[model samples]
Target: MAIADQSGRTVFITGASAGVGRQTAIVLAAAGATVVLGCRDLAKGAAVRDHIRAVTPAARVSVVALDLASLESIREAAKQVCAEHDRIDVLINNAGVMRPPRSTTADGFELQFGTNHLGHFALTGLLLERLLPVAGSRVVTVASPAHRQGRIDFDDLQSERRYRRSAAYAQSKLANLLFTYELQRRLAVGGATTVALAAHPGGARTELNRNLPFLFRGASWGLARPITHPVEIGALSILYAAVDPGALGGEYYGPDGLFEFKGQPTRLESTPRSHDAATQRRLWEVSQQLTDVRYDALAKSR
Candidate 1:
Protein backbone atom coordinates (compact mmCIF):
# COMPACT_ATOMS: atom_id res chain seq x y z
CA MET A 1 0.00 0.00 0.00
CA ALA A 2 1.09 3.56 -0.63
CA ILE A 3 1.56 6.15 2.08
CA ALA A 4 -1.62 8.24 2.10
CA ASP A 5 -1.88 10.90 -0.55
CA GLN A 6 -0.47 14.06 1.00
CA SER A 7 -2.63 16.41 -1.02
CA GLY A 8 -2.67 19.99 0.26
CA ARG A 9 0.26 19.31 2.61
CA THR A 10 3.51 21.22 2.36
CA VAL A 11 6.93 19.76 3.22
CA PHE A 12 10.23 21.60 3.19
CA ILE A 13 13.37 19.50 2.88
CA THR A 14 16.97 20.65 3.02
CA GLY A 15 19.62 19.17 0.69
CA ALA A 16 16.98 18.00 -1.70
CA SER A 17 19.26 18.32 -4.69
CA ALA A 18 20.64 14.81 -4.22
CA GLY A 19 20.79 11.55 -2.27
CA VAL A 20 18.19 10.59 0.34
CA GLY A 21 16.98 14.17 0.51
CA ARG A 22 16.25 14.09 -3.18
CA GLN A 23 14.62 10.67 -2.99
CA THR A 24 12.39 11.69 -0.09
CA ALA A 25 11.27 14.77 -1.99
CA ILE A 26 10.35 12.63 -4.98
CA VAL A 27 8.31 10.21 -2.87
CA LEU A 28 6.34 12.94 -1.12
CA ALA A 29 5.82 14.90 -4.30
CA ALA A 30 4.46 11.77 -6.02
CA ALA A 31 2.03 11.43 -3.12
CA GLY A 32 0.69 14.95 -3.89
CA ALA A 33 2.54 17.03 -1.30
CA THR A 34 3.94 20.41 -2.19
CA VAL A 35 7.65 19.72 -1.82
CA VAL A 36 9.95 22.68 -1.39
CA LEU A 37 13.44 21.65 -2.37
CA GLY A 38 16.09 23.41 -0.31
CA CYS A 39 19.48 23.28 -1.98
CA ARG A 40 22.65 25.31 -1.76
CA ASP A 41 22.88 25.15 -5.52
CA LEU A 42 19.80 26.52 -7.18
CA ALA A 43 20.66 25.04 -10.58
CA LYS A 44 20.87 21.56 -9.14
CA GLY A 45 17.74 22.21 -7.15
CA ALA A 46 15.90 23.19 -10.30
CA ALA A 47 17.02 20.04 -12.02
CA VAL A 48 15.68 17.90 -9.21
CA ARG A 49 12.42 19.81 -9.25
CA ASP A 50 12.11 19.33 -12.98
CA HIS A 51 12.84 15.65 -12.63
CA ILE A 52 10.10 15.25 -10.08
CA ARG A 53 7.64 17.11 -12.27
CA ALA A 54 8.60 14.94 -15.19
CA VAL A 55 8.07 11.75 -13.24
CA THR A 56 4.98 12.87 -11.41
CA PRO A 57 3.33 15.29 -13.78
CA ALA A 58 1.00 16.48 -11.07
CA ALA A 59 3.77 17.00 -8.52
CA ARG A 60 4.07 20.41 -6.94
CA VAL A 61 7.72 21.13 -6.31
CA SER A 62 9.65 24.36 -5.89
CA VAL A 63 13.39 24.94 -5.72
CA VAL A 64 14.84 27.36 -3.17
CA ALA A 65 18.46 28.35 -2.74
CA LEU A 66 19.65 27.30 0.69
CA ASP A 67 23.19 27.19 1.99
CA LEU A 68 23.24 25.80 5.50
CA ALA A 69 26.81 26.90 6.01
CA SER A 70 25.75 30.54 6.23
CA LEU A 71 23.27 31.95 8.72
CA GLU A 72 22.43 34.76 6.31
CA SER A 73 21.53 32.23 3.64
CA ILE A 74 19.39 30.28 6.09
CA ARG A 75 17.51 33.42 7.11
CA GLU A 76 16.92 34.44 3.53
CA ALA A 77 15.66 31.00 2.62
CA ALA A 78 13.34 30.86 5.62
CA LYS A 79 11.93 34.25 4.76
CA GLN A 80 11.23 33.16 1.22
CA VAL A 81 9.60 29.91 2.33
CA CYS A 82 7.36 31.58 4.89
CA ALA A 83 6.31 34.16 2.35
CA GLU A 84 5.41 31.50 -0.18
CA HIS A 85 3.47 29.21 2.12
CA ASP A 86 1.14 29.73 5.06
CA ARG A 87 1.84 26.43 6.72
CA ILE A 88 4.60 23.83 6.60
CA ASP A 89 3.38 20.44 7.82
CA VAL A 90 6.84 18.97 7.90
CA LEU A 91 10.43 20.25 7.99
CA ILE A 92 13.11 17.67 7.20
CA ASN A 93 16.56 18.58 8.46
CA ASN A 94 18.22 16.32 5.91
CA ALA A 95 21.17 18.36 4.67
CA GLY A 96 24.48 17.26 6.24
CA VAL A 97 28.18 16.83 5.70
CA MET A 98 29.81 13.55 6.62
CA ARG A 99 33.46 12.85 7.65
CA PRO A 100 34.84 15.71 5.61
CA PRO A 101 38.18 17.37 6.10
CA ARG A 102 38.39 20.08 8.74
CA SER A 103 36.76 23.18 7.38
CA THR A 104 34.94 26.21 8.72
CA THR A 105 31.57 27.54 7.71
CA ALA A 106 30.93 31.13 6.59
CA ASP A 107 30.21 31.86 10.26
CA GLY A 108 33.48 30.20 11.35
CA PHE A 109 31.96 27.17 13.10
CA GLU A 110 33.20 23.73 12.12
CA LEU A 111 31.61 22.64 8.83
CA GLN A 112 29.84 19.51 10.07
CA PHE A 113 28.60 21.15 13.27
CA GLY A 114 27.52 24.30 11.52
CA THR A 115 25.84 22.75 8.49
CA ASN A 116 24.42 19.57 10.01
CA HIS A 117 23.17 20.95 13.33
CA LEU A 118 23.23 24.75 13.67
CA GLY A 119 21.79 25.33 10.23
CA HIS A 120 18.69 23.22 10.87
CA PHE A 121 18.42 24.58 14.39
CA ALA A 122 18.23 28.13 13.09
CA LEU A 123 15.89 27.29 10.23
CA THR A 124 13.42 25.57 12.57
CA GLY A 125 13.57 28.44 15.04
CA LEU A 126 12.87 30.95 12.32
CA LEU A 127 9.92 28.95 10.96
CA LEU A 128 8.40 27.98 14.31
CA GLU A 129 5.61 30.52 14.05
CA ARG A 130 4.30 29.13 10.79
CA LEU A 131 4.40 25.67 12.29
CA LEU A 132 3.02 26.37 15.76
CA PRO A 133 -0.49 27.28 14.64
CA VAL A 134 -0.71 24.19 12.49
CA ALA A 135 -1.96 21.05 14.20
CA GLY A 136 0.13 17.84 14.18
CA SER A 137 3.15 19.40 12.53
CA ARG A 138 6.59 17.78 12.74
CA VAL A 139 10.31 18.54 12.50
CA VAL A 140 12.31 15.49 11.49
CA THR A 141 16.08 15.68 11.87
CA VAL A 142 18.44 13.23 10.16
CA ALA A 143 21.21 11.85 12.34
CA SER A 144 23.62 8.88 11.99
CA PRO A 145 24.96 5.72 13.61
CA ALA A 146 28.23 7.58 13.98
CA HIS A 147 26.60 9.38 16.90
CA ARG A 148 27.21 6.26 18.94
CA GLN A 149 30.94 7.04 18.83
CA GLY A 150 30.43 10.73 19.44
CA ARG A 151 31.37 12.72 22.52
CA ILE A 152 30.25 16.30 22.96
CA ASP A 153 33.49 18.09 23.75
CA PHE A 154 31.98 21.27 25.05
CA ASP A 155 35.35 22.90 25.60
CA ASP A 156 36.45 22.27 22.02
CA LEU A 157 33.19 22.55 20.16
CA GLN A 158 34.91 23.85 17.08
CA SER A 159 37.65 21.27 17.40
CA GLU A 160 39.94 24.29 17.56
CA ARG A 161 42.36 22.48 19.82
CA ARG A 162 42.45 19.15 17.97
CA TYR A 163 40.69 18.29 14.71
CA ARG A 164 39.75 14.82 13.57
CA ARG A 165 37.31 14.57 10.70
CA SER A 166 35.45 11.46 11.85
CA ALA A 167 35.22 12.64 15.46
CA ALA A 168 33.87 16.03 14.43
CA TYR A 169 31.25 14.42 12.17
CA ALA A 170 30.15 12.07 14.94
CA GLN A 171 29.82 14.96 17.35
CA SER A 172 27.58 16.81 14.90
CA LYS A 173 25.34 13.76 14.39
CA LEU A 174 25.01 13.40 18.15
CA ALA A 175 24.10 17.05 18.36
CA ASN A 176 21.29 16.38 15.87
CA LEU A 177 19.64 13.80 18.16
CA LEU A 178 20.13 15.98 21.20
CA PHE A 179 18.51 18.86 19.38
CA THR A 180 15.52 16.74 18.35
CA TYR A 181 14.83 15.45 21.86
CA GLU A 182 15.38 18.84 23.48
CA LEU A 183 13.11 20.58 20.98
CA GLN A 184 10.37 18.00 21.56
CA ARG A 185 10.56 18.57 25.32
CA ARG A 186 10.28 22.32 24.84
CA LEU A 187 7.37 21.91 22.45
CA ALA A 188 5.53 19.77 24.99
CA VAL A 189 6.25 22.24 27.77
CA GLY A 190 4.94 25.05 25.60
CA GLY A 191 1.82 23.01 24.79
CA ALA A 192 2.44 23.22 21.09
CA THR A 193 1.38 20.32 18.86
CA THR A 194 4.48 20.68 16.68
CA VAL A 195 6.40 17.49 17.39
CA ALA A 196 10.15 16.90 16.85
CA LEU A 197 11.63 13.57 15.78
CA ALA A 198 14.70 12.11 14.01
CA ALA A 199 15.73 9.52 11.40
CA HIS A 200 18.88 8.07 9.82
CA PRO A 201 19.53 6.70 6.31
CA GLY A 202 21.55 3.86 7.81
CA GLY A 203 24.57 3.55 5.49
CA ALA A 204 22.74 4.19 2.26
CA ARG A 205 24.77 4.80 -0.86
CA THR A 206 24.79 8.51 -1.46
CA GLU A 207 27.08 11.28 -2.65
CA LEU A 208 27.69 12.21 1.00
CA ASN A 209 30.73 9.98 0.84
CA ARG A 210 32.49 12.40 -1.52
CA ASN A 211 34.69 13.39 1.39
CA LEU A 212 35.91 9.88 2.24
CA PRO A 213 39.47 8.81 1.49
CA PHE A 214 39.84 7.21 -1.93
CA LEU A 215 40.65 3.79 -0.48
CA PHE A 216 37.82 3.95 2.03
CA ARG A 217 35.45 5.05 -0.70
CA GLY A 218 36.53 2.14 -2.81
CA ALA A 219 35.97 -0.27 0.03
CA SER A 220 32.47 1.06 0.68
CA TRP A 221 31.54 0.73 -2.98
CA GLY A 222 33.24 -2.61 -3.50
CA LEU A 223 31.52 -4.00 -0.43
CA ALA A 224 28.24 -2.33 -1.38
CA ARG A 225 25.82 -5.22 -0.84
CA PRO A 226 27.49 -6.05 2.44
CA ILE A 227 27.63 -2.47 3.70
CA THR A 228 25.29 -0.08 1.91
CA HIS A 229 21.76 -0.02 0.48
CA PRO A 230 20.24 2.10 -2.26
CA VAL A 231 19.22 5.66 -1.41
CA GLU A 232 15.52 4.74 -1.90
CA ILE A 233 15.62 2.16 0.88
CA GLY A 234 17.54 4.61 2.99
CA ALA A 235 14.98 7.34 2.42
CA LEU A 236 12.18 5.12 3.82
CA SER A 237 13.28 5.96 7.35
CA ILE A 238 12.92 9.66 6.63
CA LEU A 239 9.52 9.05 5.03
CA TYR A 240 8.39 7.22 8.14
CA ALA A 241 9.56 10.03 10.36
CA ALA A 242 7.82 12.62 8.24
CA VAL A 243 4.47 10.89 7.67
CA ASP A 244 3.95 8.20 10.31
CA PRO A 245 0.70 9.14 12.08
CA GLY A 246 1.54 6.90 15.01
CA ALA A 247 4.99 8.44 15.45
CA LEU A 248 5.40 10.30 18.72
CA GLY A 249 7.31 13.39 19.68
CA GLY A 250 10.97 12.77 20.51
CA GLU A 251 11.02 9.35 18.88
CA TYR A 252 13.67 8.15 16.40
CA TYR A 253 13.50 5.91 13.32
CA GLY A 254 16.16 4.04 11.37
CA PRO A 255 16.76 0.77 9.55
CA ASP A 256 15.97 -2.48 11.35
CA GLY A 257 18.55 -4.48 9.42
CA LEU A 258 21.88 -5.76 10.71
CA PHE A 259 23.76 -3.04 12.55
CA GLU A 260 20.83 -0.81 11.60
CA PHE A 261 22.40 -0.36 8.20
CA LYS A 262 19.77 -1.54 5.71
CA GLY A 263 16.15 -2.56 6.21
CA GLN A 264 12.66 -1.23 6.73
CA PRO A 265 12.13 1.85 8.87
CA THR A 266 11.75 0.98 12.53
CA ARG A 267 11.85 2.71 15.87
CA LEU A 268 15.43 2.75 17.12
CA GLU A 269 17.33 3.90 20.20
CA SER A 270 20.09 6.44 20.19
CA THR A 271 23.18 6.56 22.37
CA PRO A 272 23.05 7.33 26.10
CA ARG A 273 24.95 10.54 25.48
CA SER A 274 22.24 11.65 23.05
CA HIS A 275 19.67 11.37 25.83
CA ASP A 276 21.56 13.46 28.37
CA ALA A 277 19.31 16.30 29.49
CA ALA A 278 22.09 18.62 30.57
CA THR A 279 23.98 18.22 27.30
CA GLN A 280 20.86 18.72 25.20
CA ARG A 281 20.03 21.92 27.06
CA ARG A 282 23.60 23.18 26.82
CA LEU A 283 23.84 22.40 23.13
CA TRP A 284 20.54 24.17 22.52
CA GLU A 285 21.91 27.29 24.19
CA VAL A 286 25.16 27.17 22.22
CA SER A 287 23.31 26.64 18.96
CA GLN A 288 21.14 29.69 19.58
CA GLN A 289 24.19 31.77 20.37
CA LEU A 290 26.00 30.68 17.23
CA THR A 291 22.99 31.04 14.94
CA ASP A 292 21.56 34.19 16.54
CA VAL A 293 18.10 32.61 16.27
CA ARG A 294 15.72 31.98 19.14
CA TYR A 295 12.59 29.89 19.59
CA ASP A 296 10.62 32.83 20.94
CA ALA A 297 7.26 31.12 20.34
CA LEU A 298 8.36 28.31 22.61
CA ALA A 299 9.02 30.80 25.39
CA LYS A 300 5.66 32.51 24.87
CA SER A 301 3.92 29.15 25.18
CA ARG A 302 5.54 28.52 28.57
Candidate 2:
Protein backbone atom coordinates (compact mmCIF):
# COMPACT_ATOMS: atom_id res chain seq x y z
CA MET A 1 0.00 0.00 0.00
CA ALA A 2 1.04 3.59 -0.48
CA ILE A 3 2.28 5.78 2.36
CA ALA A 4 -0.80 7.74 3.36
CA ASP A 5 0.61 10.25 5.80
CA GLN A 6 3.54 12.49 4.84
CA SER A 7 2.70 15.95 6.08
CA GLY A 8 6.07 16.54 7.68
CA ARG A 9 8.19 14.06 5.77
CA THR A 10 11.36 15.32 4.14
CA VAL A 11 12.96 13.73 1.06
CA PHE A 12 16.49 14.59 0.02
CA ILE A 13 17.22 13.47 -3.54
CA THR A 14 20.39 13.79 -5.59
CA GLY A 15 20.18 14.54 -9.32
CA ALA A 16 16.88 16.16 -8.58
CA SER A 17 17.21 18.51 -11.50
CA ALA A 18 16.08 15.92 -14.03
CA GLY A 19 14.41 12.59 -14.75
CA VAL A 20 13.45 10.25 -11.94
CA GLY A 21 14.56 12.44 -9.05
CA ARG A 22 12.81 15.46 -10.50
CA GLN A 23 9.58 13.60 -11.13
CA THR A 24 9.74 11.88 -7.75
CA ALA A 25 10.17 15.26 -6.08
CA ILE A 26 7.02 16.57 -7.70
CA VAL A 27 5.01 13.51 -6.72
CA LEU A 28 6.33 13.51 -3.17
CA ALA A 29 5.70 17.22 -2.74
CA ALA A 30 2.12 16.69 -3.83
CA ALA A 31 1.95 13.97 -1.20
CA GLY A 32 2.91 16.65 1.38
CA ALA A 33 6.60 15.98 1.79
CA THR A 34 9.33 18.60 1.90
CA VAL A 35 11.65 18.01 -1.07
CA VAL A 36 15.28 18.99 -1.39
CA LEU A 37 16.61 18.88 -4.93
CA GLY A 38 20.37 18.34 -5.11
CA CYS A 39 22.13 19.29 -8.29
CA ARG A 40 25.61 20.00 -9.58
CA ASP A 41 24.52 23.23 -11.20
CA LEU A 42 22.90 25.78 -8.93
CA ALA A 43 21.21 27.62 -11.78
CA LYS A 44 19.71 24.49 -13.31
CA GLY A 45 18.64 23.32 -9.89
CA ALA A 46 16.84 26.61 -9.39
CA ALA A 47 14.94 26.12 -12.60
CA VAL A 48 13.72 22.74 -11.40
CA ARG A 49 12.75 24.25 -8.03
CA ASP A 50 10.72 26.87 -9.88
CA HIS A 51 8.94 24.21 -11.88
CA ILE A 52 8.14 22.36 -8.68
CA ARG A 53 6.87 25.54 -7.04
CA ALA A 54 4.75 26.40 -10.03
CA VAL A 55 3.14 22.98 -9.95
CA THR A 56 2.68 22.51 -6.23
CA PRO A 57 2.16 26.14 -5.22
CA ALA A 58 3.45 26.34 -1.68
CA ALA A 59 5.59 23.28 -2.27
CA ARG A 60 8.34 23.09 0.32
CA VAL A 61 11.30 23.03 -2.03
CA SER A 62 14.97 23.94 -1.89
CA VAL A 63 17.93 23.51 -4.25
CA VAL A 64 21.52 22.98 -3.17
CA ALA A 65 24.69 22.59 -5.21
CA LEU A 66 26.10 19.08 -5.14
CA ASP A 67 28.80 17.66 -7.37
CA LEU A 68 29.13 13.91 -6.94
CA ALA A 69 32.60 13.81 -8.46
CA SER A 70 34.20 15.56 -5.47
CA LEU A 71 34.14 14.33 -1.88
CA GLU A 72 34.65 17.86 -0.64
CA SER A 73 31.55 18.89 -2.51
CA ILE A 74 29.59 15.97 -1.06
CA ARG A 75 30.75 16.92 2.44
CA GLU A 76 29.82 20.53 1.86
CA ALA A 77 26.39 19.52 0.58
CA ALA A 78 25.81 17.38 3.66
CA LYS A 79 26.89 20.24 5.92
CA GLN A 80 24.54 22.63 4.19
CA VAL A 81 21.73 20.11 4.55
CA CYS A 82 22.37 19.50 8.24
CA ALA A 83 22.49 23.21 8.88
CA GLU A 84 19.21 23.73 7.08
CA HIS A 85 17.21 20.71 8.13
CA ASP A 86 17.33 18.77 11.36
CA ARG A 87 16.26 15.49 9.80
CA ILE A 88 15.46 13.84 6.51
CA ASP A 89 12.83 11.10 6.26
CA VAL A 90 13.98 9.79 2.91
CA LEU A 91 17.30 9.84 1.05
CA ILE A 92 17.22 8.95 -2.66
CA ASN A 93 20.60 8.27 -4.23
CA ASN A 94 19.28 8.98 -7.69
CA ALA A 95 22.06 10.97 -9.29
CA GLY A 96 24.31 8.93 -11.57
CA VAL A 97 26.40 9.03 -14.75
CA MET A 98 26.34 6.34 -17.43
CA ARG A 99 29.02 5.24 -19.90
CA PRO A 100 31.45 8.14 -19.74
CA PRO A 101 34.71 7.20 -21.37
CA ARG A 102 38.19 7.39 -19.83
CA SER A 103 37.76 10.01 -17.13
CA THR A 104 38.46 10.12 -13.42
CA THR A 105 36.61 12.02 -10.73
CA ALA A 106 38.09 14.68 -8.47
CA ASP A 107 39.08 11.85 -6.13
CA GLY A 108 40.85 9.91 -8.93
CA PHE A 109 38.19 7.21 -9.27
CA GLU A 110 36.61 6.26 -12.59
CA LEU A 111 33.71 8.58 -13.45
CA GLN A 112 30.74 6.15 -13.41
CA PHE A 113 32.12 4.01 -10.62
CA GLY A 114 32.99 7.09 -8.62
CA THR A 115 29.94 9.21 -9.32
CA ASN A 116 27.35 6.46 -9.30
CA HIS A 117 28.58 4.18 -6.55
CA LEU A 118 31.26 5.84 -4.42
CA GLY A 119 29.67 9.28 -4.33
CA HIS A 120 26.30 7.93 -3.19
CA PHE A 121 28.11 5.54 -0.89
CA ALA A 122 29.87 8.36 0.90
CA LEU A 123 26.80 10.59 0.86
CA THR A 124 24.54 7.98 2.42
CA GLY A 125 27.14 7.02 4.97
CA LEU A 126 27.60 10.65 5.95
CA LEU A 127 23.85 11.08 6.41
CA LEU A 128 23.00 7.77 8.06
CA GLU A 129 23.71 8.87 11.62
CA ARG A 130 21.23 11.69 11.22
CA LEU A 131 18.69 9.38 9.63
CA LEU A 132 18.90 6.22 11.77
CA PRO A 133 17.32 7.73 14.88
CA VAL A 134 14.31 9.02 12.98
CA ALA A 135 12.45 5.67 13.32
CA GLY A 136 10.83 5.45 9.86
CA SER A 137 13.80 6.71 7.91
CA ARG A 138 14.49 4.93 4.62
CA VAL A 139 17.37 5.24 2.19
CA VAL A 140 16.11 4.61 -1.34
CA THR A 141 18.84 3.96 -3.89
CA VAL A 142 18.59 3.55 -7.67
CA ALA A 143 20.25 0.72 -9.53
CA SER A 144 19.92 -0.53 -13.12
CA PRO A 145 18.90 -3.60 -15.11
CA ALA A 146 22.23 -3.27 -16.85
CA HIS A 147 23.70 -4.64 -13.65
CA ARG A 148 22.67 -8.07 -14.86
CA GLN A 149 25.73 -8.05 -17.07
CA GLY A 150 28.06 -6.80 -14.31
CA ARG A 151 30.73 -8.58 -12.39
CA ILE A 152 32.88 -6.78 -9.85
CA ASP A 153 36.48 -7.17 -10.90
CA PHE A 154 37.85 -6.19 -7.52
CA ASP A 155 41.38 -6.38 -8.91
CA ASP A 156 40.50 -3.50 -11.22
CA LEU A 157 37.58 -1.79 -9.54
CA GLN A 158 38.64 1.50 -11.08
CA SER A 159 39.00 0.00 -14.56
CA GLU A 160 42.57 1.33 -14.65
CA ARG A 161 43.49 -1.57 -16.89
CA ARG A 162 40.37 -2.04 -19.01
CA TYR A 163 38.32 1.13 -19.42
CA ARG A 164 35.47 0.01 -21.65
CA ARG A 165 32.71 2.52 -20.84
CA SER A 166 29.86 0.00 -20.52
CA ALA A 167 31.93 -2.37 -18.39
CA ALA A 168 32.73 0.35 -15.88
CA TYR A 169 29.15 1.61 -15.82
CA ALA A 170 27.71 -1.85 -15.28
CA GLN A 171 30.22 -2.62 -12.56
CA SER A 172 29.29 0.56 -10.71
CA LYS A 173 25.60 -0.19 -10.98
CA LEU A 174 26.26 -3.67 -9.63
CA ALA A 175 28.11 -2.08 -6.75
CA ASN A 176 25.03 0.00 -5.97
CA LEU A 177 22.91 -3.13 -5.51
CA LEU A 178 25.57 -4.85 -3.46
CA PHE A 179 25.81 -1.83 -1.21
CA THR A 180 22.05 -1.51 -0.83
CA TYR A 181 21.52 -5.17 0.01
CA GLU A 182 24.49 -5.32 2.35
CA LEU A 183 23.36 -2.11 4.04
CA GLN A 184 20.03 -3.71 4.84
CA ARG A 185 21.69 -6.84 6.17
CA ARG A 186 23.91 -4.78 8.43
CA LEU A 187 21.08 -2.59 9.64
CA ALA A 188 18.97 -5.62 10.44
CA VAL A 189 21.74 -7.20 12.47
CA GLY A 190 22.21 -3.96 14.40
CA GLY A 191 18.46 -3.45 14.93
CA ALA A 192 18.48 -0.01 13.39
CA THR A 193 15.07 1.26 12.30
CA THR A 194 16.57 2.66 9.14
CA VAL A 195 15.79 0.65 6.00
CA ALA A 196 17.97 0.33 2.91
CA LEU A 197 16.00 -0.39 -0.23
CA ALA A 198 16.63 0.01 -3.98
CA ALA A 199 14.64 0.71 -7.12
CA HIS A 200 15.57 0.68 -10.82
CA PRO A 201 13.96 2.59 -13.61
CA GLY A 202 13.82 0.35 -16.66
CA GLY A 203 15.25 2.57 -19.40
CA ALA A 204 13.02 5.48 -18.68
CA ARG A 205 13.69 8.48 -20.78
CA THR A 206 15.64 11.01 -18.74
CA GLU A 207 18.28 13.64 -19.30
CA LEU A 208 20.93 11.25 -18.02
CA ASN A 209 21.95 10.78 -21.61
CA ARG A 210 22.39 14.46 -22.37
CA ASN A 211 26.12 14.22 -21.98
CA LEU A 212 26.47 11.52 -24.64
CA PRO A 213 27.69 12.31 -28.12
CA PHE A 214 25.10 13.93 -30.37
CA LEU A 215 24.41 10.79 -32.36
CA PHE A 216 23.94 8.61 -29.31
CA ARG A 217 21.89 11.23 -27.50
CA GLY A 218 19.70 11.71 -30.53
CA ALA A 219 19.33 7.98 -30.98
CA SER A 220 18.45 7.49 -27.29
CA TRP A 221 16.06 10.43 -27.24
CA GLY A 222 14.33 8.99 -30.28
CA LEU A 223 14.11 5.51 -28.79
CA ALA A 224 11.04 3.86 -27.23
CA ARG A 225 12.49 3.01 -23.81
CA PRO A 226 14.18 5.78 -21.82
CA ILE A 227 12.44 8.37 -23.93
CA THR A 228 9.43 6.08 -24.04
CA HIS A 229 8.26 6.00 -20.45
CA PRO A 230 6.66 9.17 -19.27
CA VAL A 231 8.90 10.79 -16.70
CA GLU A 232 6.02 10.22 -14.28
CA ILE A 233 6.14 6.46 -14.87
CA GLY A 234 9.93 6.58 -14.63
CA ALA A 235 9.47 8.06 -11.17
CA LEU A 236 6.97 5.43 -10.00
CA SER A 237 9.37 2.75 -8.80
CA ILE A 238 11.35 5.33 -6.85
CA LEU A 239 8.18 6.87 -5.39
CA TYR A 240 6.93 3.39 -4.56
CA ALA A 241 10.14 2.41 -2.87
CA ALA A 242 10.37 5.68 -0.99
CA VAL A 243 6.84 5.62 0.46
CA ASP A 244 5.20 2.28 -0.11
CA PRO A 245 4.82 0.43 3.19
CA GLY A 246 5.32 -2.89 1.46
CA ALA A 247 8.74 -1.90 0.21
CA LEU A 248 10.75 -3.86 2.74
CA GLY A 249 14.24 -2.74 3.68
CA GLY A 250 17.04 -4.42 1.73
CA GLU A 251 14.62 -5.34 -1.01
CA TYR A 252 15.32 -4.50 -4.66
CA TYR A 253 12.39 -3.34 -6.81
CA GLY A 254 11.79 -2.40 -10.44
CA PRO A 255 9.08 -1.98 -13.04
CA ASP A 256 6.80 -5.00 -12.87
CA GLY A 257 5.58 -4.88 -16.43
CA LEU A 258 7.03 -6.82 -19.39
CA PHE A 259 10.81 -7.28 -19.26
CA GLU A 260 10.97 -5.00 -16.19
CA PHE A 261 12.19 -2.08 -18.27
CA LYS A 262 8.81 -0.31 -18.11
CA GLY A 263 5.86 -0.64 -15.75
CA GLN A 264 4.68 -0.21 -12.15
CA PRO A 265 6.68 -0.95 -9.01
CA THR A 266 7.19 -4.65 -8.44
CA ARG A 267 9.70 -7.12 -7.07
CA LEU A 268 11.60 -7.69 -10.26
CA GLU A 269 14.28 -10.32 -10.19
CA SER A 270 17.95 -9.43 -9.93
CA THR A 271 20.72 -11.60 -11.32
CA PRO A 272 21.83 -14.47 -9.12
CA ARG A 273 25.06 -12.62 -8.55
CA SER A 274 23.14 -9.80 -6.92
CA HIS A 275 21.77 -12.23 -4.38
CA ASP A 276 25.08 -13.92 -3.68
CA ALA A 277 25.97 -13.33 -0.05
CA ALA A 278 29.66 -13.93 -0.66
CA THR A 279 29.91 -11.49 -3.53
CA GLN A 280 27.75 -8.94 -1.78
CA ARG A 281 29.98 -9.06 1.28
CA ARG A 282 33.06 -8.72 -0.85
CA LEU A 283 31.55 -5.67 -2.54
CA TRP A 284 30.68 -4.21 0.85
CA GLU A 285 34.22 -4.60 2.07
CA VAL A 286 35.69 -3.18 -1.12
CA SER A 287 33.27 -0.29 -1.10
CA GLN A 288 34.20 0.49 2.50
CA GLN A 289 37.87 0.42 1.59
CA LEU A 290 37.42 2.54 -1.52
CA THR A 291 35.03 5.16 -0.18
CA ASP A 292 36.73 5.02 3.21
CA VAL A 293 33.42 5.69 4.94
CA ARG A 294 31.67 3.25 7.23
CA TYR A 295 28.02 4.13 7.72
CA ASP A 296 27.47 1.32 10.20
CA ALA A 297 30.09 2.74 12.53
CA LEU A 298 28.66 6.20 12.11
CA ALA A 299 25.22 4.91 13.11
CA LYS A 300 26.75 3.46 16.24
CA SER A 301 28.25 6.82 17.21
CA ARG A 302 24.74 8.20 17.45
Model 1 clash tally, residue pairs: 0
Q: How do the residues 196-243 of candidate 1 rate in per-residue lDDT, one tens digit apiece?
A: 999999988888887776754642555455767888899999999999
Q: Give candidates' CA RMSD values in order.
A: 1.3, 2.2
User: After TM-score superposition, what is the CA distance of residue 224 in candidate 1 from its true location, in Å?
Assistant: 4.4
Per-residue CA lDDT of model 2 for 1-302, tens digit only, reads 25476789888999998888888888888778999999998898999899988988978999989999998999889888888888889999999998866899999999999999999999998888668778879999999988988989988988988888888888888888988888888888888888999999876877777656665464356545443566778788898889988888988898876677677789866788888899989877777787777776545734
- Span of ten consecutive residues with least summed lDDT in model 2: 218-227
Off by over 4 Å in 1: 218-220
TM-score result, candidate 1: 0.97
List the candidates' TM-scores in order: 0.97, 0.93
Q: CA shift at 132, candidate 2, in angstroms? A: 0.4
